[model samples]
Target: MSRRNHTDKNASGDPRKRTGAPGVSAENGDGGYNAGIAVFSYIVGGIIVWSLIGWGLDYLWGTRWIVLVGALLGAAGGFYLSHMHGLTSSRNPAGGSGAASGPSEDGNSNAK
Candidate 1:
């Protein structure tokens, strides 16, 4: 008369379990949120880091306008990096599909 703890480790000591509901999409998954956060962090981090560098340069050179340029350059670089990453991921065929890729006769995919 004891209840089974399905959430805990199974008999074989394997932690993987497929007990959850299926048919979940990436838009509703954590992947999209994580990607967004990564992009945002890149942009923010670039701006902050470059602005600090520019401030240091200005302090050393006794200039007052290089900080703005540095900030703008940092933002542009961040945007470019994010855009490239987005493009690369979008171009990947396995990106949109949440399935394991298999080998094809035509040898188009690297999957085995």
Candidate 2:
């Protein structure tokens, strides 16, 4: 009467034991609220500050187009900054370049 180990490797070779939960994987477990919340806050705050600056500039220059341009630029810059910050933070802390290492469908890195 020996108990079978369900966690033992299956015929396909993958471990039968679950990692995190049913659907949750290792990648999804990392970076909880700090990633999404912090990035969102920074972007929103930056946009607000930029909008204020744009309004001031329009007031001083007496041109509405300047404010519009500023708003657009601010949005773009904020989005870019947020994306970069997320990318950097998601990387390895040991300065290991943190590039994702996995097999590609086309057998090349450029295959997307």
Candidate 3:
């Protein structure tokens, strides 16, 4: 029932303390935490905003199914956004599995 100071040494007493996610450390000042929050916002915000829009449409037009469609669309959009931003492989894609890595008119390529 007591508050724990995450900035200080944890209960485990390990000097090199870590947080909820692997390789993420608030003490280390990494942006991983911010990135996690942004991803979550994308998913939840999409659902909430789209659902409200769907509700409005359903009310104005006297329909009962557009809500489902809007919800599904929001989920898909959210997932797409989350995948594009949250997933490291999709962001960097140094494995040559991503778009824009190929040579373009500017001769930009993932040479490394």
Candidate 4:
């Protein structure tokens, strides 16, 4: 008598296969942030940074509204650039979203 070997099969009768890992999509397997989120974050971050710089400059130069205007323009430009670059993932190192590198001279990231 001959014995038959049975293999696991899906409902469709195709051999069942296991995916390599979870949280990973077949597309863009880098495991980074979704393209939308990254672009939004970059745009927002750039705007905030540019605005802050403009505000500081205005304060130092005693110019009213000048810094605000410049900040607005800078923010707009930064947002456009970020969008163009498709700055998607702000997490995975492959996406270049890692934390700040090195230490500040004042021993604080927020040091002026």
User: Of the candidates shown, which would achieve the greatest lDDT relative to the real structure?
Assistant: 3
Q: Model 4 Cα displacement at 96 (Å)?
A: 31
lDDT of 4 by residue, 1-112 (tens): 9753343432355545422123334245343455455555655677677778888888898887866676677668766765445343243737544667777566776866
Reference-based TM-score of each model:
0.51, 0.46, 0.47, 0.41
Candidate 4 overall lDDT versus native: 0.57
Scored by CA lDDT, what does every candidate get? 0.63, 0.60, 0.64, 0.57
The residue-level lDDT of candidate 2 at 5 comes to 60
Better of 1 and 4 by TM-score: 1
**Higher-TM-score candidate of 3 and 4:** 3
15-105 per-residue lDDT for model 1 (tens digits): 4642212222223333355666666776787898899999999999999998988899888877776676552144433455565566656
Report each candidate's C-alpha RMSD, comma-separated, in the order given. Answer: 11.7, 14.4, 11.2, 18.9
Name the candidate that leads on TM-score: 1
- Pick the winner on TM-score between candidates 1 and 3: 1
Question: CA lDDT of 62 in candidate 2?
Answer: 88
Q: Residue-wise lDDT of candidate 3 within 1-112, one digit each (tens)?
A: 9876656564576646543333334443333666577566767878888888999999999999888888888877877876654332233325555567545775546455
